[model samples]
Target: MNEPLAQRLRPKTLADVCGQQHLLAEGQVFRRTIESGRIPNMIFYGPSGTGKTTVARIIAENSGMTLHKLNGTSCGTGDIKAVLKDIGTLAGAGGILLYLDEIQYLNKKQQQSLLECIEDGSVTLIASTTENPYFYIYNALLSRCTVFEFKPLSAADVERGIRNALKKLSASEPQPVTMDEDACAYLAESAGGDLRKALGCLDFVVTAAPVDEGEKHVTLGMVQQVTRRTAMRYDRDGDDHYDIVSAYQKSMRGSDPNAALHYLARLLEAGDLPSACRRLMVCACEDVGLAYPQIIPIVKAAVDAANMVGLPEARLPLADAVILVATSPKSNSAHDAINAAIADVQAGRTGPIPRQLQNKHFDGEDAAVKGQNYKYAHDFENHWVEQQYLPDVLKDVKYYTFGDNRTEQAARAYWAKIKGEDKL
Candidate 1:
């Protein structure tokens, strides 16, 4: 390019873009929008440096659309209308696209103005936000726009980007430069799913040493020294997705708090929100149990907070919840009991419903099955009518041995009596 390597390498066409195959496919929403010359107001929500602006530029270039960009921080409510005045109506010849970045930062009023503009079709609103739109954006404006999310560039995407960057740089800067596979991989990890960051790192690596007149590869040592970022072997989306979370669950099950938190952190870093939430819920019921049942609310609150405030910011709540879940008194009586019952059922352990608890409240025939043998527990002394509930296959099966923690000891003692254990 006539500019710096970063600028020269900036993708100008949709074909040059990567990681948004979902949007770029033939006759897709994005391509259709470009072909039709009119796009509904939409938001491109995603993480930093994932080429949101680049793709926006590509769309604008292809559609013959001029744009007025408002990064939510810089413009206010009035600025929006005033710009609308300048960009008036575009019915016939061309359309004006209003590009807003970090739209989550837009206050209620600014968002409202944009909403009105979209309703009038004055301009196609193409907004981008790093934050989750549900929590940050005003629902009204969000409803008006066709929201599209931009996913973080994968390691492979970033690697491809680095190679492209080197090609562009060599076209102008000459003096062959290369990033070895290991170094490229490290650069992708260090970039944290950000394409611009990966390009920035690659730019630094090759430029670190004097340009030899021949092809020279950037080494892992040079990358480590220059970027100070570690490469993760496991795929954020695939390789370790299930395995890491499973280990995390087992760690919590085994009463290892530190290991549990480590896994929680990994989930947050990997953008695995639902997995993180599910794990916290498990930890709450299993590890934290009734002991300091207060931990349950904390875990619930964190789960809500994670959904309310996602990644980068949401990481805090997840971290806090995992720690509390990890450190709280551990118990899995409930989980073990349920799981044991599942195993019994799966093993073809069917038994007639105990006449004492059979459902029989429907019709005359159903009623016959109900009171025929059922005994109300409330009528029994202390609401303690005990009877065998396990199927024949697990007639003698027991689960959930309580931990040594004080909160669990009393429960252990109580259940141990029912279990016929020698000690609590």
Candidate 2:
């Protein structure tokens, strides 16, 4: 079988690697460490196509260690044992360097098996995981290894990689393979920071592009045909899901309708309507609270409409809710009030309920002693009356601070007038 273009284009040295400048840039700690030739047990944590495997290979070649590759998905304790058995043999003379990919898939026992080899210096481990290492990696193993995070490449970085891939393709093929500038830009932007994905797309386009006068010409249309939908890094059960949802709600709370819509579109593109809907409703109440009280029901209605219609169409109602919440006057007084009350209750600051406010039905013996003196507001002027509703300990404590927004200020004014405290 032919070697995949992405595989063929893999960086042979640290100098050739694209992106990950944070880790691999000149004078960077990681780059210095790798150059020092004293490799440590490390974990590479990041999304796919960020060059974790490629970097490991480079490290293995430089470290003078016998490199052994195993995937967590298929390897078991037996496979680990097989690798460990070579510790004293000629194959392990230079010391073993184990590059375990998808390390998150390995169970506790499987990971635990590596602890001994790692401790004794028999194996220098370089594990790569697409998921969060702290969440999936074994605690003991995690403690022993230094973790290095790999961030997604920028569009410019991916574009650099695409240019390099084109150069390599032209040199390897009998007929020159050239991509139009627009097509190169389109492929890079569409890759969503995954070099492997960009190379894969280029590979497909080159193989499928028609040869004109002994040259394969790749155009914007060819790139578009290969990547109709842009790559989106979202796993419903993963960290990206939570991150995007957080950004989605925060954008609305921050009152940036454009940013809010951008995140909303990402969630909808990932087919995560439930997360988008739930966040919109919460933002309406939490961020747009008393200032725009009616937005609560308005967002709820939009959410209901979205759930009924379902995606594509669902995005419309959800978009309306997102925009409404984003543009609405904002307040967190109601949310803050409830949280403060809950905290006081949790801290046992709540005393006995006032005698008048206590349930009368269960006060058979105490009814006569306590007296049913609950004042009725209907009989008073302005249909309002002062009453102590909180427990004795918290009677003087105020939790609901009226927000500065017009609606809340108006309500504050109305209450002050009704109580004849406006002059105070």
Candidate 3:
């Protein structure tokens, strides 16, 4: 039987892998580990088509261990125990490497089955997960494994893989198969850093395009016909979700309306309306802040409208919210001020509250407590009185740094006037 393009093109060795220079480069820990033939329990986490499975196979081959592969999505503890039993048959020989794919799918109770075997060194385990191992894998299982992160293939890497695939197809067929420059670029760029998807699109185009002059000529139209559209990698339960949202928030903070709108569109298209609005709300408070405090209510109302309308109509309100936030004068003073206060309290800087500031309206007011000396600001000039509001320990600390926007600058001037100073 003929193998699929992805399986047939799997890298036979570590050097054959395309990307992940951080891990596969010379003098790296992983290269050293493989060369030393000391295979440790590892968790390879990344997006699909990043060579996690291929890397695990290479390690097993280099280590000269009997390899047993299982899919965590389909296999259960019973399947694992069966593999362990088979490995026991070769106790005197070198141990086996159990390659578990999608190990994040294994539930907590299921993961516990490997604990004893892993601890006793009966079967060395290598697990791969598309989701973050730290969040999905059990803490105990993670503690036993050395986690290595993989990144998506670059456009250059995808192009290289496509050329290699074309070469293989030409070798097997009577006629040469070729792709035009435009077609190749389109395929590589539209794959979204996924080599498997790139190869799949290449296969589809090759099969659909008509053969001409003893060769199959692939064009931009053919590539578009096969691909239809490029997809954004935005899985709500995966790291891509967090990554895109981070980009969206950062774009708003950096005041790039174009980039911010692009990410917002991606989020809403992925049916993550709630997350999209929630991010806008965060940007309204954290980025615009006191520079445009009124924006908070507007953003909240926009988000509410988006949620109420949902989908087709939600994009309108979301777009409005994004523009309002991205174009507004940015300031983080309110956000930073709260964070500084929190840090101080967390670090044990909290002190007793001033007696006069305590609630005097509660039941019996005593002289030492609520009856303590307190100045009435209404009776003073300018409706302001000089008094210590912060705890004694934090009296010298200034948490709010004035921003460069007009509103904040005006507020800063007013505060200085009340404090009898020209500057904070």
Better of 1 and 2 by lDDT: 2
RMSD of each: 12.4, 2.3, 3.8
lDDT of each residue in 1-424, candidate 2, tens digit only: 9788889999999889989999999999999999998999999999888899999888987788888899999999899999999999999999999999999999999999999889989999999998999999999999999999999989898999999988989998988998899989989899988999999889998999899999999999999998877577788988788889999999999999999999999999988888999999999999999999999888899999999999789988888888899999999999999999999999999988888887763567646565658888899988878998998899899999999999999999999988888998
Worst 10 residues of 2 by lDDT: 361-370
Query: lDDT rank, highest first?
Result: 2, 3, 1
Q: What is the C-alpha lDDT profile of model 3 across 1-424, one tens digit per residue?
A: 8566888878888888888889999999888887898788999999998789889888877778778889998999898887888656755268878899999999999899899888888789999999989889999989998999999999998888898889988887677899899889888988888888888888777777788998988899889887655545667977999999999999999999999999998898788998998999999999999999999999999999998998979999989989989999999998899999899999999797776676654536444544556778899988898888888988889888999999999988897888789753
Model 3 C-alpha RMSD to native:
3.8
TM-scores of the candidates in the order shown: 0.60, 0.92, 0.83
Candidate 2 local accuracy as lDDT?
Answer: 0.91
lDDT measured at residue 399 in model 1 versus the true structure, 0 to 100:
65
Clashes (backbone N, CA, C under 3 Å), per candidate, total: 0, 0, 0
Instruction: Give model 1 RMSD, 1 decimal.
Output: 12.4
Compute the lDDT of residue 125 as modeled in candidate 1: 82
Q: What is the C-alpha lDDT of each candidate?
A: 0.73, 0.91, 0.87
Residue 208 in model 2: shift from native, Å?
A: 0.8
Q: Which segments of candidate 1 are over 4 A away from where they belong?
A: 1-5, 87-93, 213-217, 230-287, 290-424
- lDDT for model 1 comes to 0.73
- Worst 10-residue stretch by lDDT in candidate 1? 230-239
